[model samples]
Each structure stands twice: as structure tokens, then as C-alpha cells.
Target: MGRAIALGLPLLVVAEIAVFVLVGSWIGYPWAVLAVLAASFAGLMLLRREGMRAWRGFIAAANSGQHPGERVIDGIVGLGAGVLLTVPGFVTALTGLVLLFPPTRSVARRGVQRWTERRVSSAVAGDLFGPRKVRVRRGAPDVDGAIEGEIVEPR
Candidate 1:
């Protein structure tokens, strides 16, 4: 992921810049600027709305003694959208707008959840039982008809 980010960020920046220039050329520069501004403003409004909704849902879930995971996830995604919208770029703004919408946000939420789960599982698996190894001996006794193994202490 880190390597992908290292490579992708530069390409993303170049693509965004090229898009901006092309848009500016197609429509007058002033109009292009206005369009970007308008998109940002709209995104901000969407961010605020989604943020409020997520907050309210969180509060309601908490008050009702229910798990707030979904609400919290929504709030986090909305916050991300707000940040992206705040950034002065068309690509980020469009991405933010997509995250602001419920259908798109749900898709993004699932992706985020899956990514988080994978990261957490890997982290847990990495530090399991303080570095241990399994050893299979040729004469090991079987237990309950299951293959037997032993933990090999570090030499």
C-alpha cells in the first residue's frame, strides 16, 4: 500500500492538473474556476448535511445502548469527505461529493471496513504469542486422532 501510494500520488496529481487545464481550455478559465468553486461549495453543503446526520445517528444509537459502529463509520467518512472538499482540487471535490451521497458512501464504507479488517488482522497475526515456531517430530504421539505438533523454543 505504501509503495502504491508513493507511485499513485504523483500520478494522481498530474492527472488532476491535466484535467484542470483541459477543463479550463474547453470552458473559459473564469468559468472553469467558477465551476470548481461551485463544486466545492456544493460539497461543503453535502459534508455538513452528512456530518449532522451521522452525528445524530451516533447519538441516538448511544442513547439506545446499541453499537455505534455504523454511525461512527458514517461520521468518519463524512469527515473525510469534508476534508477532501475543503482541498482546492476538482478530483478531490468530485471524490468528496461521491462520498457524501448515501449510496456511494455505503460502497466506500464497505471498502473502508474491509481494508481496516485486513490491516487489523495482519497486525494481530504479526505479533501473535511473542514469536513462536511449530515443530513436527517424526515419533510424536497423536492426540485424539489429530496430528501432534510441539512449540520449538528458540535456541
Candidate 2:
């Protein structure tokens, strides 16, 4: 992940710079950079504040004795999105906004749900060091083959 990010960052920077140059040539460099900075900052601020609001709601639901695991996940997503929006790049900022938006995010969330279902379902999520999961169907086996509790003497 780190290596992917390290390599991708430079490419992203180059793309952003090209866009910046194009916009700067049309409008002026100072205004273009300022606009990008302002937009990124605004998006970050909005999502960060909204994420906090969602976190507070999650806490409230948890305190009410309800399962808030999904809320916690949303909080995590929101935090990541918020941070991404703060970065100085159009793509990153747009990705963050998509994550923050409910309609778009719901699709992303469903993908996550499917991934969790395949990779780690309830058994894995429920416990890490717990016993391995085993599914037994009906009529598999029973204790009727042996006498109850007491062992028979060897003939």
C-alpha cells in the first residue's frame, strides 16, 4: 500500500500540475492555485465537520444499547474521506466528496459489504482468537452409538 501510494503520488502530482497549468494559463497562476487550495480546504472542512456530526450520532446510538458497528465503519470512512479532501489534488478531493455523499457512498458501502461477506463474515468479525467455525447439518452424528456416560467393561 505504501509503495503504491509513493509511486501514485508523483503521477497524481503531475496530472494535477498539468491541469493547474492549463487553468492558470487561462485565468492566471495565482488565482488558479488559490482556487484549488480554497476548494480543497472548503471540502475538507465540510466533510470533517459532517463526519464529526455523524460520529456524535453514532455515539448516541451506541449509548442507547444498540449495535453501532456500521456507524463506526462510517466514521472511519468519513475520517479517511475528510483527510483525502484536504489534500491538494482534484482527483483526491473528488474521491473524498464521493465518499462523503450518501447516494454515491451507499454503492461504495455495498461493495465493502460484499467484500466483508467474502473475506470475513460474522464468524471472523465476532472473534479473532476464537475457535474455528464449523457448520454441521442435521443428522450428521449423535451419541446414540455409545451407552450413556458409563463405560462397559472389556470382555
Q: Which candidate has the highest TM-score of all? A: 1
Model 1, 136: alpha-carbon shift in Å? 25
Give a tens-digit lDDT track for model 2, residues 1-155. 69999999899999878887888999998997797798678777877686887779677876886655456556666776777778876677778878978987766655554455457765654342123344434453566653223212112
Per-residue CA lDDT of model 1 for 1-155, tens digit only, reads 79999999899899778888998999878998898888778768867877898889888987887666567677778888987887667888888878878899888876775455456653442232133466876775667666667655444
Leading candidate by lDDT = 1
TM-score, structure 2 vs. true: 0.64
Model 2 regions lying over 4 Å from their true place: 112-155
The lDDT per prediction is: 0.74, 0.67
For model 1, which pairs clash? none
lDDT (Cα, 0-100) at 35 in candidate 2: 77
Measured with C-alpha atoms, the lDDT of residue 75 in candidate 1 is 79
The deviation in Å at residue 23 for candidate 2 is 2.2
Backbone clashes for every candidate come to 0, 0
Which window of 10 residues has the lowest lDDT sum in candidate 1?
A: 122-131
